[model samples]
Target: MAEKTLAGKTVEVTGEGYLVNKEDWSKEIAAELAKEDGIDLTEKHYEVLDYLRKEQAAGTTLTIRKVGKSGITDIKGLYQLFPGGPLKLSSKYAGIPKPASCV
Candidate 1:
């Protein structure tokens, strides 16, 4: 685990940077995380992140295939929106646990 400050608040995170405590999350933290990844959050990005957060909160397993069915973005669109590791990056920004499908 590791601790970092974002928006003047300290939060713990996994070594891979997933939030350790979901309750420590905030839109400010999401913005900060996105900036670090060189992503400028737009409505499209929020659509995916918001959906991921809601799904995780409901204890649903997150997967690339599942995200595609979300109607927010298809697999290709999600990759284009997040780049690199789409699910990993979006999940982190959403402040949810790293999806089991990740890594």
Candidate 2:
């Protein structure tokens, strides 16, 4: 399958939401995305990524409050990290087929 692009793509809302275009996912873009999601893009951001990956591995849904409780500190961080919020970020980066709750 062709790699996906996170820039203009809409985020999924279910399952493991990993980014489709892992190859196209650049550090700069990641940072920009993080900024868009309102995250500072620090080691803390990795916590969110790790959580999403883990949730995917376990086949579960990732909630924003749960993510924030996981150490995100700021709940509104989603606004910056994901323009579409938790569902979007999780689905976009988790690589899930397509989040049902993203819309």
Candidate 3:
């Protein structure tokens, strides 16, 4: 784990930049993370983030197909919203570990 400052608070994160402690997450931190990723975090983005966080807390592994079925957004929309790596980037901003399926 590595330490980083976010939303004016110190938090633990993995080497890949995923949050180590889910409790350390906040909307402010999400906003900062999104900014770093070049995302503006619209309501549609929040919908996916909310879904990802909830699924993560429930021990569900995240995937682009799953996210598409989430009713938050479709696969194309997700890619458009997150650009490069949708699930990975969204999970990072949502403060969850990198899903095993990511790589």
Candidate 4:
């Protein structure tokens, strides 16, 4: 485990940098995290992040296809929104665990 200062608040994180405690997550923190990745989150990005958090709390097995079917965005849009690593990056910014689907 490691600690990171996001939004000026110290939070625990996995070795890969995903938040260890979802309760510590905030919109400001998400903004900070996204900024580090060079992404400027829009309302659509928030929608996707919110969706991911909710589903993760519900213990749903997350995947790009599942997120695509979420009515938030399609596969193409998810790609455009996240670019390099869609599910991996979104889950990270969402303050959720890295999905098993991601390498």
Off by over 4 Å in 4: none
- In terms of lDDT, the poorest run of 10 residues in model 3 is 36-45
- Tens digits of lDDT, candidate 1, 1-103: 8999998999998988889998998888998998998998888898898999899889898999999999999999999999999999999999998888888
Q: Relative to the true structure, how large is the alpha-carbon lDDT of every model? A: 0.91, 0.54, 0.89, 0.95
Residue-wise C-alpha lDDT for candidate 4, range 1-103, written one tens digit per residue? 9999989899999988899999999999999999999999999999999999999999899999999999999999999999999999999999999999899
Index of the highest-TM-score prediction: 4
What lDDT does candidate 4 reach at residue 22? 90
Question: Candidate 1: which stretches are off by over 4 Å?
Answer: none
Candidate 2: regions farther than 4 A off: 4-40
Per-candidate Cα RMSD to the true structure, in Å, reads 0.9, 6.2, 1.0, 0.7
Q: 60-95, model 3: which lDDT tens digit per residue?
A: 977999999988788999999999999889999998
Better model by lDDT, 1 or 2? 1
Tens-digit lDDT track for model 2 on 1-103? Answer: 3333355654322234345544444445555555545655666555566576677668776666666676655577755555556656644544443446556
Residue 38 C-alpha lDDT in model 4: 96
Clashing pairs in 1: none
Query: On lDDT, who's better, 2 or 4?
Result: 4
Ranking by lDDT: 4, 1, 3, 2
